[model samples]
Target: MMELDPAATFRQEAADLLDSLETVLLDLGQTPADRDLIDAAFRALHTIKGSGAMFGFDRVAAFTHDFETAFDLIRKGKIDANHDIVTVSLSARDYIRALIEAPDATDPIIGEAIVEELQRLIGRGDAKGAAGAAAPPAAAAGASLASGQGGWRITLAFEEQILRNGANPLALLDDLRELGPCTVLPDLARLPALADLDPESCLIGWTVTLAADCPREAIEDVFMFVRDEMRLAIAPLAEGVPDVRPGFTLDMAEAAAEPAAPRPEALSAETASHPLPGKAAPAPAGAELNRRAEDKGSTVRVQAERLDELMDRVGELVIAQARLSQLAHSGTDLAIKAIAEEIERLASGLRDSTMGVRMVPMGSLFGRFRRLVHDLSRDLGKPVDFVTVGEDTEMDKTMIERLADPLVHLIRNAIDHGIESREARASTSKSATGRIELSARYVGAQVLVTVQDDGAGLDTARIRAKAEEQGLVQPGATLSEQEIHQFLFHPGFSTARTISALSGRGVGMDVVKRTIEAMRGAIDLTTIPGHGSSVTLRLPLTLAIIDGLLIRVGEGRYIIPLSAVEECIELTAADEARSRGRSFLSVRGELVPFLRLRELFDAQGAADPHQKVIVTAIGGTRIGLVVDQIIGSHQTVIKSLSKLHADVTMFSGATILGDGTAALILDVAQLVSLGQGRADDRTPEAA
Candidate 1:
């Protein structure tokens, strides 16, 4: 078993806190007067600071001290949320990440500069108050937190797993201190003997006494995250009693679930921790520890390399299982065939379990973009309302990470070029604010992500003129709007006259195209003049294995992603004669375009008396792929092609068959996009 690293745990917890901090900060910009959002931001900072100090992130802890104070002031109604506060706070959020990642390399001056700006913003608020001016809008509207308590008190007993949730109890305790003069007594009555103790659990609870100068909400905010997990009660302190002290013992079973990062609702909706199965009840002080101990096994952090290694092993097992299946079918041994079937079932279950482990929600990628949009709107002076849909869609972890840079480029392009200026939009009777939407959804075996904008659409005339000037098109070229837009993906192709911070060096779209293609994905462009434009990307759900429909084209065998296959039908001699002049298939009253793989690949061979067509759906269009034979279904383990075959758009990747022969996997999206309905059989289409 690998040893648990406390430092690594601290870093991961700190990262989660930072993500939560960012979410709250961005939310404050939209609803600046939201005191709950403000306090939420403060709590995130306090937790990061406390955890940092405990885990030896001194720079992070020290920097967060002043940062927490700024938010604390907002919570206390001492300051109001304004553009300057939110902007500087966002910058501080990024800086805190830098401090966490590389403290030694990060310039301390940046942090000092941000803190100075924050101070100036706070000072200006103080200035108005000193002049006896009217309170800020929020405070005037009574949106700010109450200043004085109504003799209220709170008793909080957090679940034992609070520490696991990446929340530092000490941080909450420290925040309570900020409320007013308060005394905290730690309760260790529920603490088991040291031998049976879990360091990650919050074994000790706390009782507190405080002056009635602070509101009850302020105290409750301290235990907000663990509120559902633990017991919390409040009441007014007795008139004669200086403080309320209640002694309570926690039920061991009640706090069974650890308060890990999942309860925060931020941190990419971090998963919750469930008690490990088969865990023996609390052992006495002297009992021997279990060597197979697994703590709160609902979630475990394993290195990416380890997962990759495990996947490689699974792939080999699948191949071996395939060989067994092939042998079982060839031989006439019922018992051997049954064994192979059982092995197949076990292998399939293991594959699914392994894949699920690597699946993460698309929300993790979408959450980081909110800050990007916020910052871009401010910088570009473009009042764009950014929205996201289908954020909960699950995707492979590897694909999710690689998707970030390309998506950033597309989203930036949408704002910088696809969307019009506020004035431009207003002139066209459009709303002052343009809308940029990012969405993702599962389409068959692939995920479709779209970045769309409601602004001035692509200027095809302008694109054509630029293409002509650059000698990319002939002088009298009559290219379609899409053909003109394709020029945008050419290297160094930009129409902007000035280069700004966000874009306009003509170097982004080409990179976006190449990056998406490298992942065996395809991108689409659609636009309507004076209306809007959208870019849709189609990507495979996983890179490892998939169920494929295997077919033979001449002497070559190819696999099609089974998710896209609707059905297989015979291509009779009469249908072939009819399609000889036109590659069209009549499927359930729909005229679908068809492609003959044998002819398309120039595979020299005699025509088979019998041919089959695999009806596949891409996007919403049905396309037929004619093959010589249907080889049934296959457990395809995808293997990426070499650089030599990378430019070939017809095939996404290749895989090893049961007979140890290589079979290429067809690129269904690309084929469908390139297939033109009512077009000539030999004339290939381009997208």
Candidate 2:
């Protein structure tokens, strides 16, 4: 029921177009001669330009016009999409995004410079001249036979709702005129009466006799933004040309007067809705209109903030349902219990549905990195082949967004420090082009995103020397490889001999670790002596709502994320006495380290004789948590801890219980870490 902001809508849509433009440019860098990529790039640019102009983003429109002109030449095979051209185009795309997103802060000089560089790459000194030169090659000879001159007859009839979708027919007309001479005539046959007119709707169509010696493709490009939402026909200008004016078969007045039904279209030569201009017309005009209608009705673009607010409401509903269930169980009201049960079912369904809506495929996030990798490869003079796998895997939108910066840091470190230089690699019998592969897949209820680089692996001796030199560890301390790797994540920890623009101010990896842990995720690192290194980030699919196992350590209740719990077992008297001096428990012939929540929280109670162990697996290690009681499963809506308790590592967050009491959510990673430390204390080497 809320109206969308037109400017905000344009900015969002332009962002998507710019992303596509970047991707196309990157692809063109590989296959410079691919006509399809060239045309696709041009179409993306054209749409951005048209939509930007429609939305009063004048700077964006003007800047993209120059960019669109340069790509038009590539589409026509006049210019090759070489590395230089692709690089400049990518910069141009960024500038246009800046112009749309932050026009006040964007420098016009930078935009002009990008355009000049693009033109220079394409062998054109004048941007305007290059655009003007895109006319049909036949125009150089003479006029065509149709109109006794080189010209075409074009008719355009847009849907009545076109204006509402932020398209302007006048802009198309203006674009057409820029090619050559034009005589525009309005078709008033379908015009409604003045009293019956809807100011927001467009009914009048246009017939233009264009006298420019241009290709049909050039004219079709003018309507790139509205091809699917309109009826259009183009033919050589000649006497008795097939009248395609039947586009206005569905009058606005009649459509509003009658019962709503699918809009109709009339078949005419060259009259049909195509995905893009100049593509083969796949369906009749009527069928195309119906298809467009179906497509439009299939999706709704809701704002992200709205989705977040909906999720908040769903969370609240879940908490209230929990309270109602508690009351229903306590009281002996059969009718109230039935109602509570029904509400619980509805609430569960709503939570799942809302969470599903927030689940976005990881491909969208991964695609942006292609451009980043491209730029880094060029900047570092490293011909690296960046590969991504499991792009179809979906994750929470919030998690994906927060993961961006961390992943960026990881990848930058991989290329700057992990990947060997071309010359360095040749001496070691390695491939000339280094490889960095990023992959994601499901591991139980968690998603594992790994960034692996096949280069000289981390120098373990160097890391230890640096750690000992900095007094982080004892001079004669015995440590595991995993423990030595942990030193890399210490603040201001770096083993690089020298600093460069890419890395080595002793930053990046530490921040990556902190950020991942902040999201209730764990980071794992593994390296071979000379093969490669991989960092896998284990993260929950959604952070908003999770299935949790409620437990009581003392008087205080705590919720452990159900996803991380492997199993719960009883701590018998014999087992407790055997491990009295240590926190290790034997589970199925494996010595699993355990942590006592009672001692950790300093709970005020006598130790329970029959405590339980909740086994959890984190980063391929099992850690057991000892608790007094195991409550049943509960749907947990995680709430962030306040700044007052932000430094507490044991608890990740808090959630509301059925009795409206707040219970802290256990931070499994921190507990696993503590258990590991405890296990180290019990080692003979430490002794």
Candidate 3:
């Protein structure tokens, strides 16, 4: 029987709480007068303090106690919530995160320095929230009409894996008791026999009736980290709420005794599938979404590894369905074909559902950047007005996690190098404050995220000169502005005269480019010299699976992401021969560059007499891919290549076909880059 470490749970919770703190501080940084934001920041710090104490993180508790008290002073109007105060607060928040992350390794000197800095910012005696101090706003205005202590009933049933997730139900219980007088009754019916018991799994539930003056959110904060890993409900302890006394209090001696069965308000009526003992009737077929929303508070947190496992199973099922479809097509029986079609449809729906589960809002990732912008603007002596749009746009959670580092680098570079200095902005007649906009939107099957900076755009001449100096480009070589900008992504590429802590290290932009491309995404830059620069990243909504156009290129078969495919056209041998020196096809008054995968891969077979050109668009540029046969569309379950084929950028990944043969999924973005020479030789493609 392995007991879960409570310290680990506190660390995870601290991480989440710190994120919340950062968000609130960023909000306050923007609107210091917003009392709601002030309160939010206070609450986040309070949670970290209390929960940290419960799990034996005394250092964290002590640090946050002061931090919370400072915010408490702000809440009471004893101290002003100005920009300098917020700046110091944000720094203290980062220090607390460090303490929580590495309790022993963290330098206490740093924490003390931050505390002193905060005190100095708010003045000597203004940072305290002592009892003799001024009363809070609610009580200050003589609106202190006291009411009966609210009696609330809360039911919490933790998932079995809660213990393994580093959560401490006992610590959560401790947090609840500290809120007010409370009675906790354990539900141990789920406890298995000794032989069958898994010590790492949580088998206990609790029904607590608490009488407290704190807000309901404070009570919910007990299980903040485990909120999505448990079933919890809070309703007023009204009449008929079983086993809930009007004002429950626990005697020290009888605290361990089991209380009677107590339940909250009847599961909201919408929770048709109740977790507790109460019977719930099923809803109609169309009520799933409503029911889901109702049960939003009762989510079971799943491990990322578990989602990956399920994805693997779904991929297998899709592969089996593909085989079934092939078998059905070879047979004459209509019923078999129909069954195959039904399975295909089911597999498609399942894939969508799985992907949706993995799709989290982009704002979850973007929120952290607000603080980055705030800090960079201040440090660089530049004023920045940060804005975001389409934040509700969602993408694969995995992609979001991997995208954060690259985005941080890109953003830092933008602020450090792309944006001009304050004096320079004034000289240009632009506003003293520059603006940076981060936006995400869905375009067809891809998500377009743009990081646009209203700063001095790319200095193409400087970039070209740097390239020439580094021997990266031929001497006296002429390069387009776009090509010169592309050189910034080359390894160890930089035009900065001096290196600093942030940019000029010649590491970030290249890493950003590599990261985006590694996700089978494209990065494009558009800049107006002196006006600003905007970098747009086009990425697939999901990486696990895709609808791909299966094609044969000579002896090899490959896949073109169907989202990139516009339409297909016949490229007769006559046209190929007549257009010998040409590398493009004229269609509808547009010159579209085309690539031959057979030539690209050097596959051993002759080109078909009438080869097919699949028109594809990436980063708004339409290109044609020449292949032999257009087999059809497929639900491609992407299986990444082995380390042996790691350098093969042309193929994003390989997937198992219906015939059990492997076909590589084409990296259209990379292919487009590969065909850049053709674009240079022929008429440029419309971007």
Candidate 4:
């Protein structure tokens, strides 16, 4: 039996309630007139207040009561669900959470200020609204009577294994008494003789009659802890049955007048027709209906760490399956081959299902930007309309989580620095309301997320001047547009003359670049003189595993993500000799920069006479890698390098092959940039 901590359970429930409240509040902002949203928000608050008080969070309960009252009014249409009211309630929600978590940390002045704001939004006129007020005695009496007038009959029978779940039926009965008055009768019919009794098993059931004016939900909540393991039946007492309180009361009429001989079958029929006094009704047709209904609506909320753990298990399974397939291929037995094929199919399906579990829609990441744009527009006095497309596009959950901060920096930069003032925009004959478009889509096997702003594009001339001033470029250097624009990502390089909170400190873009690169992704920028700038981030679908094209550079093996591979070609002696110092190969008259992985990685073995070139593309630039042998495709589980090798920029990460050899995963973007530089350096025009 596992003992349960009621306090911990209360805390978890409170946090979930708070999150539900926030989500509903956000939804209400979008649809202010939605009754369902208002009801949901109210229910979340009500549950939090009731549960908080039950769990000894009196201060939280008290603070939340006022907010609940406000929403109750809104729910009943006594007051409109206005923006001011919603905002005030949202602030109060945070304060309530604080009260629950750190009751003593409350500040009187801040509390008074919030109360005043709440009153003003409530339209209660003045500070008098903050003071406690008493209702008339008659009204109070009526409310009390309305609250505790009805008596309920509840029968609770738990499974024999209920004790194994650490539940005490007597404790639940005691909690029910707190509502008003309850009489409990323990049934011993199911209890075994003392000689044969099992101490660990629950041998007792209970019948309880509770007198309370509270809703049925309150009584149900008492047993919520053991609801899954217990069977509960609740029914309201017949009208005006005050004497029918929960104690053991044998009916006097039946005891005094019924000594008649009973026919066994007739007696059984009569007993079935009318249940024993104080006993619960039989399980109705709809008794288990709500449980099944709830099952349809229920979803398990798992922590992200659990998903990561499951993914690691799946990766190990994939590796094992690879080993099994390797062995099966060497055997001549038909049955072994058949079983191996089946295992391979099952493993593949399991891998896909696990990956699907890790995929999350990008909408949650996009939602935060709405608030960002709203605040930034007001702060800068700029009219900006943030638009998003392809929000339904899904990416690996881990990837999306890591992407939020970098995306925020990009959006802030666009609003603070990229977009010009209204007057400046007018002079340029552009619309007064600037637009920023955030879009995401799947490109091949990669997820491409792009942020574009219809604002003043990057000034290449100013960038070039700043680069020279910062000594990032040589004096009188004739740099291309791409070279000039790339300076924006250099550490501590900013064209802004003044700094602000949002941006212009030049500390963010460099971090964004580094973060994207660390994710084994690439970032690219494009802009027009008068049009806007677009930054695209291309990342692999998953970080844990990838389909890799394994090839050998001399004696060393390297992996190129098959997602990025375009094609492979044989580079003969005639072609290799012709392309000497220059790395460009004429493939059907198209120039593609070629990189010798052997020389790049400094492999010990000599290059083969018959070499292969694997051409790959990043954005629009195509580059080729020259390797000795193509080792076919592999399911590579990526393992990051130790901090000691973190400074190596060429190899993004490493993967272990089925045969226990290590292969480096190529950073295609970095390799392409290096290859293009080497090609340009060898050109006669550059010389």
Overall lDDT per candidate, in order of appearance: 0.75, 0.81, 0.77, 0.74
TM-score of 1: 0.75
- lDDT, model 2: 0.81
Candidate 3: regions farther than 4 A off: 1-5, 125-298, 333-335, 475-478, 620-622, 678-687
How do the predictions measure up, each by TM-score? 0.75, 0.87, 0.77, 0.73
Better of 2 and 4 by TM-score: 2
Q: For model 3, what is the alpha-carbon lDDT of residue 164?
A: 57
RMSD of 3: 8.5
Residue-pair clash count for candidate 1: 5
- In the range 170-269, model 2's lDDT, one tens digit per residue, is 8889998988889998877667799998987788777787897676677777865456667666767554243332333344454333222123433422
| lDDT for each residue of candidate 3 in 277-307, tens digit (9 for 90 to 100) | 3213212211222244665664545779999
- Model 3 residue 228 lDDT score: 46
The collision pairs in model 4 are 147-213, 148-213
Q: Tens digit of lDDT per residue, candidate 1, span 595-661?
A: 8888888988796888888898754557898888998899889888888986798898888888778
Clashes per candidate, residues 3 or more apart or on different chains: 5, 3, 0, 2
lDDT of 4 at 62: 69
Looking at candidate 1, the ten consecutive residues that score lowest on lDDT are: 283-292
